[model samples]
Target: MAATETVAERPDYDPVALAESLASAADKSAKVLGDFIARQAAAGKSMVTDEFGLTQAFLELAAKMLSNPYRLAETQMNLWWEYSALWQSSMLKLMGQSTTPVVEPAKSDKRFRHEDWEEHFLFDYVKQSYLIAARWLHNTVANVEGLDEHTRRKVDFFTRQYIDALAPSNFALTNPEVFRETIASGGQNLVKGLNNLLDDIERGNGQLKISMTDSKAFELGVNIATTPGHVVFQNDLMQLIQYEPATAKVAKRPLLIMPPWINKYYILDLREKNSLIKWCVAQGLTVFVISWVNPDERHAAKDFVDYMLEGPLAALDAIEKVTGEKDANVLGYCLGGTLLAAALGHLAAKKDKRIVSASFMTSLIDFTGAGELEVFIDEEQVSSLERKMSERGYLEGSHMANTFNMLRSNDLIWSFVINNYLMGRDPFPFDLLHWNQDSTRMPAKMHS
Candidate 1:
């Protein structure tokens, strides 16, 4: 009888409190629904269908698996054998015997960090069961015989997303910490969690934008981007910021930095102690950084060639005018580096030699080994994006941020979901995250 008793049967459990919390949660849930309905009615936006072409990719994967029955059978048999081992191990653990977990999470996986995940028998079983299934799914999909490279990559990427979403840690009932919190708080946490979800969806204009950190925690040119600088010149496209000289003797060649327009330039000058801009000033070099315009429809016609002619090329002419320096050392980061490389080729063609030295940071000159980002770079997807951009005049900043976030969904996306929506907690203030969420728009012509 004692063995059969559950946690709810214990003296500490209060049914009355649980009932009250549930009632409150139901009221809040109605408010959530009503707000959602009103927002939809106001916007009257239509649903976008399969913008990523995931359906076609999955169908192809299914066809390949169906044609290779033997391979599928072998993979299924392997999974069954693993499940059997896990059952035996779990049985031993339930009998108060020491047994090894059939599978362990990777060292970097933080979902299973709570002590209850290991200390409690039921949760330990759930964790191992989920891990085993996740491994089997990944291996099976990865080994599918005859899919093209692009289709295979898309399948694998989405497969990881599917598994990550279904992880036991994500759901409250299966997550020991959340379960304990629910019981202790009599489900008030859940009511709060629902409120947080509604607030976030409303903030995103009917889309869910999970808050990674407190949005009000930082400001431009204050706590961040605090390096002393003067806007020495401005073109229609960018502002040339010249930092105040830190030393009496300045270097003969000024240092000009061209940052990627995909993000704001303040990323390089985030804070004083670690700011590259500040360090350059202290190095006795007159530094000039290009702050790209946060473009809108008016600037939609600006293309890559326009960016080159008006961006670094224009900055070069401005730098020469400001500091009496005819030649300057140029550095570009990421997309900025790509643009600089193109400008070099253009200048070479015209026999111009205003740049003395050039440096690139995480810049790509070749596309053959573009890594995981290649999954979204095919002609079909590019054309689809072009059509979308034509409607908006530019790629939305949030869309670009969402794409980058998908690359590390577990870290950037799901973790916050559990913390902010499942646990009913406010995100901690983080400067780096603040910077990341402060995304900038990309002009349609330049982006295309």
Candidate 2:
């Protein structure tokens, strides 16, 4: 038999007192720290002049401190305290237990033992103050509107410094690895998953299987005399099919299909089911595709100017000559698009009006916000590439392919790595992969 014991009711917990005390302590700490920094700045003419080394030292110290488990734990604890204080005060006020709380203070841990934090704090305050000062200075100069050359140059220098300092990457030295790790981890997972799915699809669809009969039949067809209209134009840079109309009648205007040099042109004519070129021909548009010359060591000396003259422009001339159309509809894709834009600019400068209408697919004209490509396009990287191209007659097709592959490594390289090395399986046959493997070389001058 169990004796029934009466349980005493537990008292309700009130976080209001704790929240108020924390809020007061944080406010006092912030004021004291702010005052101390003010005094330090007042003593020194400028934060940058007085404590640049200290600032750098603090940054290094912060990196080392964050790497330590105990220091990280302390940071977390302090952050939690600040967050809890804010949360409790908000909740208490909502529950009518207390008034709204003051804003929580910035979480700084002295226990981490770094002189840099104080220096960093002072530096930031001074930098911000200088920015405000610079802005006023700029406005004053602008209002004067007749500053001397030297004075204008000084103003410009200050403006540049102020703007450059505001750049997000300037403070990136503080927590760079954190951002990098976050980006790399997410990108790796996404690419790995996508590649696995692609591999699975390739396996299920039996895309890799090449039947002997099919191979024999395709080879036989290639050898046999086909219709004169079925012309597969092959060169060092490009491969394209030129479809001529059976009848004497042809389209009034000929349209040239341009694809990104980064990838083969076959994406535009994947199959009979979804062939843009076939559809255009059927719709009374004379279609011609410019297969780029796959470059090799022999073509390394080529440059951008050479590509403009020989690649799209050559195709345009050939198309006009073949079809006898004075004006042609020019279509460009990606890099091809960029080349076309440049050609158009060159033509516009010369007032050349042979082109009727220009269409660009996923093409960029202005280099602003080019995103990830910017990392590889800086002076140092471009210079190195130029040097390599100069040494070699042409840029290797494999090198170009590798660069593109690195841009999306998880999908391009890692998937194959996992399938071939980890899973011990052969690469699944994909049209895109097939085209990717069929890379073309760039003339050295063109590539540079």
Q: Candidate 2: TM-score? A: 0.49
lDDT of 1 by residue, 1-448 (tens): 6666775564464668767756876776677667777866675644555667898999999999999899999999999999999999989989999998899999899999999889899999999999999999999999998999999999999899899999999999999988988777766677678777877876776677888999887888878899999899998899999999999998989999999998889888989887999999999999999999999988989999999999999999999998888899999999899999999999999999998899999999897988888878777788888988887799889888988999999899988888887788889988788888888998899888
Measured over all alpha carbons after superposition, the RMSD of each candidate to the real structure, in angstroms, is 3.3, 20.2
Per-residue lDDT of 313 in model 2: 71
lDDT of 2 by residue, 1-448 (tens): 1333312232333357545644654565465556656755665524344111223333443454455667456545755564566456545644656443333112441111233322333333333333344444444334333344434443444344454434222232232322243243433332333334344434324222111111222221233222224444444455555766644666788887788765667666644556666677667677777767656676666677777777777776666666677788889888879988998888889898778899998889888877545434544556667665666576656666765665655456544543442333345644445556656666766655
Candidate 2 minimal-lDDT segment of 10 residues = 206-215
TM-score of each: 0.92, 0.49
Specify the poorest-scoring 10-residue window by lDDT in model 1.
6-15
